[model samples]
Target: MAVTFYINLAYLLGAIAFVWGLRLLSTPDTARRGNILASIGMGLAIIAAMLAPLENTSNNYGWILGGMAVGAGIGWVSARRIQMTAMPQMVSMFNGLGGACAVVLALVEVFQFYGGERTLDSGQLVIVLSTLLIGGVAFTGSLLAFGKLQGLVRDNTLTLPKHNIINQIMLLVLIVMGVMLVIQGQEAGLTMAMIFTVLALIYGFSFVIPIGGADMPVVISLLNSFTGLSAAAAGLIYENNFMLVGGILVGASGTILTVLMCEAMNRSLLNVLIGGFGGGGGSAKGADGDQVAKEVSINDAAIQLYYSNSVMFVPGYGLAVAQAQKVCKEVDDLLEANGVDVKYAIHPVAGRMPGHMNVLLAEADVPYPKLLDLDDANSALPNTDMVVIVGANDVVNPAAYDDPGSPIYGMPVLNVWEAKNVIVLKRSMSTGYAGIQNPLFFHAKNRMLFGDAKDSLNKLVQELKNL
Candidate 1:
C-alpha cells in the first residue's frame, strides 16, 4: 500500500510536468527549459514504473537498468556531437527507437502470459495486438525514413505497381490473422504472435519505402504518433498510469503537429501518406516569363543591401545544406549594426523539418523577437525594402501564388517578391525539394546572386563592411 502511494505521487507529478512543459514549448523563449522539464518528468515516470508492483510482470532490475544506462549514454553522446544538418535523421531515429521499445514490451507481455491461469480478455487482446502492430510499423518505417535522410536508402520514391492496392490487401490479411489469433487464445497464441509481428514489420517497411524524400518529415511525425499510440497500448497492458498519460500526451501532440503541417503544405493527410513529392524530378512553371535569370555581382548585391532601409532574410534547406546559418546570422548582425531594420521570415516548414531553421538560427544567437511566422512575415514583406533569400526556393516561389495548376499551388509561402528588391543567393537555377522551378528568379525586380551560399554571404558581408 505504501509502495503504491509513492508510485501514484510520482506519476501525478510527472503528468503535471509533461503538460506544463508542453505548454512552455509553444514559444521559442522557453522551449529549452520546457524540454529539460519534460525530460525530468520522463525520468521520474520511469523510476516510478520500476518500483511499482504489478502482476505477471518481470522486474529484472539488472537488465532494465543496464539497457537504460546504455541508451542514455548513447543518446547523450549523440546529442553532444551531432550537427544541426543531421537533426532530421536523428529525430527520425529516436522516434523509431520509441516504436521499437513498444514492440519489445508487447512481446514480453505475450511471452510471459503463456500457460498463465487467466486467458487474455478481449481488452488484453486489443491492447496487445494494437501495440505490436503499431510499434512494428513505427520501428522499421522510421528506420527507413532515417536511412533516406542519412543517404543510406535512395532519396527517390520507389513504388511497386498498384502500391495502394497492395497495402490494402496486406492490412486486410493482418486483420483476419488478428481475429483468428484472438479466437484461438492460449492454444495458438505464441506461434501466431510471432507471425503477426513479422507481418507488421514487413508492412511497416513497405509502407515508407514508396514515400518521397520531401515527405519524410511528415512521415516521421506521423510515425511518432504511431509510436506514442503503441506506448499507450503498452501502458494498458502494464496497468501504469504514468505510461498511459505520457503516451497519450505524445500521441496527441504528434497528431496535431502532423495535421497542422499537412494543412500548411495545403495537402491532405491522405495525399501526404501516398507520398511522391519533394524528391521527384519535376518543376512547376508559372507566370514569370523571363527564362533568362538576371545575375547580380556580390558588390552589387551588397550595394542594394547597404542602401536598403529594411531587409528580410529567408532561409531554407539549401542554407542548411551549405551549413551557412551562422554566416547568415553574421550578415543579419552587420546590417542591423549599419542602422538597417532586419528581421527573418520563417516558413512553417522551412528546412527539411518543422522548426529546423529556427534551431540553426538560434544556435547563432539570433534574437527570438526578430523571427516572424507566415502571416506576420507576409504582412511585413510588402513594406520591406529588400528581401535577401538565402538558399530558399520552394517556400518563396511565386509559383505557389500565381500558378493555380502547380503542385504546390495552394501551399503557404513567404511573399518575398512583394518586397522592393529580391536578391537570391543560390549555387544555380536548380529546383527545390518539391522539384519545382521557382518563378521568383525571373521576377522583374529579382537578381540572382549565384554562388555557394556561405561563400556568397561572406563576400556580401565583406562588401558591406568596405562600404
Candidate 2:
C-alpha cells in the first residue's frame, strides 16, 4: 500500500511534466524540446504503471507487460519510418489506437462487473456508457479521417438531404437508450451499451464524412479531443490520475487548435459543426482540355521577375511538402538585394492548417514583415509587378469570380488574378484537394512551370542569380 502511494505520487509528477511539455509546444522554437520532455514523462508513467502491485497470485502483470512491449515496438517503428507527407494519416491512426484502447478498457471493466455482480449499479452504468459512447465515436471517426487523408477514400464532401435532421434524431435515440440502460441495469444494460456503441460509430462517420479535405486538419484535431475525452472517461471509471491528467492536456490543446482553425477561416465552431464550408455542393467541374495557360522555363520566369519592382509570393501545401521554405527565403533575399521588393501572400487556411504556411516560412527565417495575410496581400496585388503562385491552386482560382455555381464561388480569395503578371509552379494541371480544377491555371496571364517544387524553385533561384 505504501508502494502504491509512492507510485501514484511519481505518476502525478509525470503527469505534470506532460502539461509542461504542452506549454513548450505552443511555440516552434521550443517544440522539439517539448516533445522530448513529453516522451520522458511518458516513460516515467510507464515505470510507475509497471511497478504498481496487482497481487502475487494475479496474472494481470504478465498481460500488461506483453501488451506494453508490443505497443512500444510498433510506436517506435511507426515514428521512425513514417514520411512527413503521410504525417496526417499517422496522426489519425495513432489517435484512433488511443481511443480503441479506452474502449477496450471500458468493455473489460464492464465484463468483470457483470461476471460477478450480474448487474451494474447506476454509477457504474453511467461510467460504462460514457466511455463506450466517447471511445466508439473517436475510434470510427478517426479511421474515416485517416482514410480521407491517405486518399484511400474520396476527399470530396459526402452529404445527403435532411442529413442534419437525421443526425439530431439519432442523437436523441442514443440518449434515450443510455437512460433506459441505467434504469434497467441487467440484460438491458449490456444490450443498450452495444446499441450506444453502434450509434456512436455511425455518428462518428456521419460527422466527418461530409467534411472536405480542406477541413481535414480541423477534423483530425476534433477527433483528437474526442480521444482525450474518452480516455478521461475511462480514467474516471478505473481511478487513474495519470490518465485523467494526460487526457485533459490532450483535450485542452486539441480544443485550442480547433478554435484557432475556426478563427483562421473566419468561421464559428458551431458553423463548422453544422457542416457548411467543408461539404461538397453541386458545383460544376471545369471542362477538360482547358490548359490554355503556357508553361515557362525557369529562365523565362526569372527574366520576367528580375526587372520587376515588386513581387508577391503565394505559398501553399506544396511548399511544406517540398520543405522549400529556406530556398524560397533565399530567392526573396536575392530579389530584395537587386532592388526588387518581395512579399509573401499567406492564405488563412493555407497548407494543412491555419498558420501552417506561416510556421514553415518562419522556420526558414523569413522576415516577419514580409509575410502578408490574405486581405493585406489582396490589397497589394493590383499594384504588384509579379505575383508568384508557388505550388498553390485553389486560392487564386479565377472561376470563383465568374462561376456562381462553383463550390468555392462565395469564398473570399487572394486578388492574384488582378496582378500584372502571374507565375505558377506546379507538377501538373490536376485539381486541388477540394476535388475541383482551378480555372486560374487557364488564365492567359498565368504561366506555369512544371516540375517538382524544390527542383523548380532551386532552378529559378539559380536562374535569378545569373540575371
Candidate 3:
C-alpha cells in the first residue's frame, strides 16, 4: 500500500510538471526551460513505472538497462549531429517512434490476454485495439513523411487513378475489421486485430503520400496529434495517470498548432488532405511579365543597408538550406553595432516546420524580442527603412495580394514590398516550395542580390565592417 501510494504521488507530480512545461512552451523566452522541465517529468514517470509491480517473475534488469543505454546513446548522437535543415525529418522520425512504442505496448497487452496470463474487460480490450489502430497509422504515416522530407521518396504528390475511391475502400475495410475484433473478443479477435493493423498501416502510407511538399508542415503537425492520441489510448490501457495527462497535453497542443498552420496558409484542413496545391515549379507571369529583375552587387546592397536606419530580415527555407543563420546573425550584429535597428520577420509557415525559423535563429543567439510574427512584422514593414530578404521567395510575393487567380491568393504574406527598399539574396530566381514565382522580385522597391545566402551575408558583413 505504501509503494502504491508513492507511485501515485510521483505520477501526480509528473503530471503537474508536464502541465507547467507545456504552458511555458507557448512563449519563446521560456521554451528551453519548458523542454527541460518536460524531460525531467518524463524521467520521473519512467522511474515510477519501473518500480511498479510486474506481471511476470522475470527479475532481469539487464535487458531493460541495455535497451535504455542504447536508445539514449543514439538519441544523444543524433540530436548533436542533425542540422537545422533536417530538423523536420528528425521530428517526423521521433514522432513515428512514439507511435510505434504505443503499438507495441498494445500488441503485448492483447497477447498477454490471449495467453490467459491476464484478463481484460471489454472496455480494456477496446482501448487496446483502438491504440493499435491509431498507433499503427501514425507510425507508418510518419515514416513516409520522413522519407519524403529526406528526398528518398518523391516530394511531389503521388496519386493513383481514382485515389479517393481507393482510400474510402480501405477505410471501410478497416472499420469492418475493427468491428469484428470487438465482437469476437478474446476467443477469435487476434486474427482480426492483425488484419486491422495491416490495413491501418497501408491507409497511413496512402494518406501521407498524396500530400505535396508545401503541405508537409501541416501534415507533420497532424501526425504529431495522432501520435499523442495513440499515447493517450496506451495510457488508458495501462491506467497510468502521468502518461494520460502527457498525451492529452501533446494532443491538444499539436491540434492547435496544426489549425494555426492551416490558417497561416489560408488553406482548409480538408483541402490540404486532398492534396494538389504544389505541383511543378512553374513561374507566374502576370502584369510583371515584361518587367525585368534588376540585380544589385554586394557592395551596392551593403551601401543601402549601411545608410538605412531600420532593417527587417525575412528568412525562409533557403536560409536553412544554406546553413546561413549564423552569418545572418553576424550581419544583424554588425548592423546593430553601427546603430541600425534590425529585427527578424518570421512567417508562421516559414521553412519546413512550425517554429523552424525561430529554432534556427535561436541557435544563432538572436534575441527573442527581435523575432516578430507575420502580422507584427507586416505592421512594422511600412515604416521600416529597408527589408533584407535572405533566401526568401513566396512569403514576400506581392502576387498573394495582386493575383486573384493564383494558387496562394488568400494566403497572408510578409509585406516586404511596403518597405522603402528591399534587397533579396538568392542563388537564382527559382520559385519556392509552392512552385510559383514571386512578382516581388520585379517590384520597383525590390532589388535582387543573386548569390548563395551565406556568401552574400558574409560579403555584407565585410562591407559593414569596412564602413
Number of clashing residue pairs in every model?
0, 0, 0
Tens digits of lDDT, candidate 2, 1-467: 89898898889889988989988886666777889999899888878876775565665877878988998999999989986556678888898888888888888876666566545579977987788878887898889888887778774346666666777787788889888877876757455566677787798777776677777777788889989988888878867788888887788878888887676555566666664443433333453563476888888899988899999999988887887778888888888889999999988777665457777787788877788878899999999999988777767766666787666665567879789999988888777655567777767778888988889889988999998
Candidate with top TM-score is 3
Rank the models by lDDT, top first. 3, 1, 2
Show pairs that collide, candidate 1: none
lDDT of 3: 0.86
Model 3: which residue pairs collide?
A: none
Better of 2 and 3 by lDDT: 3
Which portions of model 2 miss their true places by more than 4 Å? 1-5, 54-59, 117-120, 155-161, 187-189, 273-296, 304-312, 320-348, 353-387, 396-421, 428-430, 436-446
TM-score of 3: 0.96
Residue 236 in candidate 3 has what lDDT?
100
lDDT of 3 at 246: 88
What are the runs in model 3 whose C-alpha is more than 4 Å off? 54-56, 187-189, 281-288
Across 1-467, the per-residue lDDT of candidate 1 in tens digits comes to 88889899999999899999999998778999999998899889988887875653766888989988998999999999998889998998999999999999888878876557445786798788899999999999999988888878775445688886787798889999888777777776688879999999999988887777777768878998998899898989888888898889889988998998888889998888775677656657753464788999988889889888999999888888888988988888888888999999998787767688898888888899999989999999999999989888888987777777677888888989889999999898888777778888888889999889999999988998999
TM-score on alpha carbons, each prediction: 0.95, 0.82, 0.96
Better of 1 and 3 by TM-score: 3
The lDDT per prediction is: 0.86, 0.78, 0.86
lDDT of 1 at 367: 90
